[model samples]
Target: MRIEISVESPQGVRAAAAAGTARVELCAGLSDGGLTPSVGLIEAAAELIEVHVLVRPRPGDFAYARDELDVIVRDIETARKHGATGVVVGALTTEGEVHDACAAFVEAAGDLATTFHRAIDVSADSRRALDRLAELGFTRVLTSGRRRSALAGAPLIRELAGRTAVDVMACGGVRAANAAEVAEVTGVRDLHAAPRRPVGSALTGDVSYAGVGVPAGSDHFETDPVEVEALCGIFRH
Candidate 1:
């Protein structure tokens, strides 16, 4: 019955804090699937609220180049300094294995809890990825059940939870209408959502948002309050 919302803007975080949510995933450039937020915003959000903040490194794809990896590592350090409670990250090997020490990433995460992000989804094999993450000591794994949306992938997600020691968190296309069903189908207690008002993308960054894929028409990529409230209603049901 826990709720988590991803917020890219300070305004969104304030709204999420006002909504009385348990945790908030803080980042920026959500128009591109969540780029690293400024240190100021991170610190400011941390100071004003009690919600746990999970920071994302880049807004790009799950496959990170060496430089991007460095950026991710540096971003994590900044996020931690600014009071992030945890972090979300994922890196895939060519064969789709989790890059090196799943434990090392966990360790790199320091005291904050770590949740390997959707990079696990693009892997060649989900089960092997699950085992590696579990072995590496990740607190949770965010997945869409290996399908585009969580609902479609629920079965695989559920199987994953059953097969691995790591916690499985259902994500993608999670909304009020089917949040509970996805949870039920996936047997996943944790969930992640990026619900934003149907606003148009700003496109100010002049960077490519192609890989992130904005759903139809939406301005922001962070979780939307309207959606969260509705989903909460169902989850409570």
Candidate 2:
């Protein structure tokens, strides 16, 4: 099985590479479920490991406006220019179906590999969305089978994996503890995870740079190389 880690920074990419991960989905604001990474981050990550830039413009739903689609297309182009190995993207219509505009994203990517992101999980019908993605030239897709976690969505994931031409990558709340079980139950060869741990900030003060409801001196999260190694060990064994 090939393991793909969701990484937000150069350190995360280095950690994943050190642990022998196959690839990384490079992004910013991973706490917001990932957004497009900066050009520098993409270039830096590409040097460390195979990097697939996530082309999300913002947080919230995948249903995007025309401007957002344009931005996504532009981001895809930027990722390519900055040395990204591939891109992860998706879009939905108001009716929760694959948006026709996603074609522009693929067109912008040119020869780069494309992965339809977790937006498929929120589609009205994931199976139909999978078919549409395949038609749109997406070689892979990341999904939790429309459930909160891949383990809970194994039945649907297995069903999708059995018939879909596109590669099904089981994601959402994947960890070393359940990675093997998820793969076994879903019959998927690709798995996406973020083995992150909080590192306490050394700067301690009453002033805080975090968003609302976040505590002062909040710790930042980073992908732990040891955790990545543990997850990789499961597939290796």
Candidate 3:
């Protein structure tokens, strides 16, 4: 089984490489699900390991405006220029179907591998959407079976793995504890994990980055190397 780890920082990418992950989904703001990482981050990550840059322009719904899509395309090109092995992207229509504009997204990828992100989970019909992605020439689709976690959605994930020609990469809420069950139940060839370890913020005084009445804290999460190593052990054994 191929183990892909999502890393938001260059440090995370290095940890994934040391842990022997098959690939890294390079992005920023894991708190926002994921957004396109900077070109420098992509370049640095690609040097450490095979990197698949996320091309999301924003955090909200996947239904993108023309300007937002233009940004996504530009980010895709940037990722390619940085030697990304693949690009992760998705678009949806207002009615929650796969967007027709995905053609441009795929084209922007040129010869690089393209993996449709979990925007399919919010689609009207995930099975039908998977078929649509396959027709669009997607090399893979990352989904958690339209559920909160892969273990909870294993049945549907398994079905999609059997039904789709595109690779079904099980993702979302995957951790070391449930990795084996998810792999066995879904029969997937790839698994994606982003296990985090919370670290304290060094800012001590009245410094607050959170504006607009939001509570202020510098505490943040980063990929945990121990978690990555433990998860990788499942495939090794």
Best by TM-score: 2
Model 1 misplacement above 4 A: 48-59, 101-103, 200-223
- lDDT values, one for every candidate: 0.73, 0.89, 0.89
- Model 2: per-residue lDDT, tens digit, 55-174? 999999999999999999999999999998899999999999999988988899999999999999989999999999989888899999999999999999999997768999999789
TM-score of 3: 0.93
- TM per candidate comes to 0.83, 0.94, 0.93
Model 3, backbone clash pairs (residues 3+ apart or across chains), number: 0
Alpha-carbon runs more than 4 Å astray in model 2 = 204-217
Report the lDDT of model 1 for residue 162.
Answer: 90
Compute the lDDT of residue 8 as modeled in candidate 1. Answer: 76
lDDT of 1 at 15: 74
The digit string of per-residue lDDT tens for model 1 on 1-237 reads 566777877777777777666677776776666666788888888875643444455555566677767766777776777788888777887677888744545666798878887788888899998898887888788889778899888888988989877888888888878787877788878877778864555777644444245555544355567776776666664
Spell out the clash pairs found in candidate 2: none
Off by over 4 Å in 3: 202-218
TM for candidate 2 is 0.94
Clashes of 1: 4
Model 3 misses residue 137 by how many Å?
0.2
Superposed by TM-score, candidate 3 places the C-alpha of residue 77 at a distance from the truth, in angstroms, of: 1.1
